[model samples]
Target: MEVKHERVKQCLEAMMDSGQLSVGERLPSEILMAKEFGVSRETFRAAVKMLEQEGRLLVKHGVGTFVIQPLPMIPSSLERLSSIGAMIRTAQLDQGESRIKFTKEGCSPEAASALGIKLGDPVVNMERVHTANGEPVAFSMNTIPQEIAGDAFDHDEFQGKLLQFFEKRLGRKIVTADSEICVPLHIDRHCQRLLLHPQTTVLMLKQVHYDEANRPVLFSRDYLRNDVFTFNIRRTT
Candidate 1:
């Protein structure tokens, strides 16, 4: 005989397959499900916790349990340079915003190396929180030449589009960007501030955008919330 927890899991799976439950849909009450499935209430609660830890369900503090929205699949095309704004929309989630910090400053060693500039080069640092459907999804830190970003007309123009901000704020068109990624088990200070305890592990994406002349037009480091921003990638090698 299967374990009690497995039985509950099986029942949930059946509901999901039948579409009675869906991504982001709530499950029945523990009491209701226990009675409905003829299981002890204790067993039922255990099952819900198991699934919740597995990232299949979300439990609210004072509310009920709900199905989790699946992570967005990473695109197979790793060659393309996509904006954080463009990527979330591609996944069909509403994009949200919170620009934490934006200022003009001198380039640090890391920034210089990434942007191909000497140390102390003037750079504009743009920091913001990227959101998905009103949920904080990632933290982005972008740096660009002060001259381009300093121009008022361009900065205002690029306000809505981070990539466009490059072109409009600095008069430089982005040709490509290099993005590196990883998943982490621990939460960052900022992540804790966002109030998200990722059921599954979290991932990191660090990138630097460069223009046609290979000048580091923008230096960026983005920490994506693993659950909400799922990515899909298809490849053959």
Candidate 2:
């Protein structure tokens, strides 16, 4: 039923992520694709439509369905909160390297506001680029109170899963996070270089992670390459 169609959708997404289906390439005929996936034509059509809505596929009236060049979308299901590293692993894609660009021990006004700290309070700021399959995908800046980060925060040894690292260090769990997504009109030169797409639109995510006690701990701003990632949200009444 619905489960079968969901599986079909996942398979199609995997195919795209693995480069089995390149951008601008035509998908097999509906009948053939349905047969290959062992799903009914109706179910297959439903999956295709889902992908189209996600900007992963383009449907033509008479020609055929074509793969869109945008980067593989990592589903951001509203039903549950998950880390970007977890999402990448779930997609069966390499979590890749996290390049630590810089680390500073001071708070900006914006960081202070987000973390609920007073101005001039000590904070640790980290700028990093997350890659996938040797290609850059996200440029992120994370700010944490200096007391939380401590002196043990070594950029070289720190890799993926910042939440996990913070939780382990503070001996507390990140119970929840509030996030907002937006399209930015402009991206700075540094972010543009990291994304490797000078002219592409940037998708920005602003998030604040809360501890078990509902204390704001981490503030992050992530700039995602428009063509390298897509986010999906499922709304329910």
lDDT of each: 0.74, 0.78
TM-scores of all models? Answer: 0.59, 0.62
lDDT of 1 by residue, 19-59 (tens): 88998787777889999889899999888888886667899
Cα lDDT tens digits for candidate 2, 135-233 = 777778888888787775764556557777777765658888888887655656645655456556678788888998999988888887766666787
The superposed Cα distance between candidate 1 and the true structure at residue 81, in angstroms, equals 1.4
- Give the lowest summed-lDDT range of ten residues in model 2: 71-80
Could you tell me the lDDT of residue 47 within candidate 1? 87
**Model 2 TM-score (2 dp):** 0.62
Candidate No. with top TM-score: 2
Q: What residue runs in model 1 are displaced by over 4 Å at the alpha carbon?
A: 1-76, 153-158, 183-187, 193-195, 198-200, 232-234
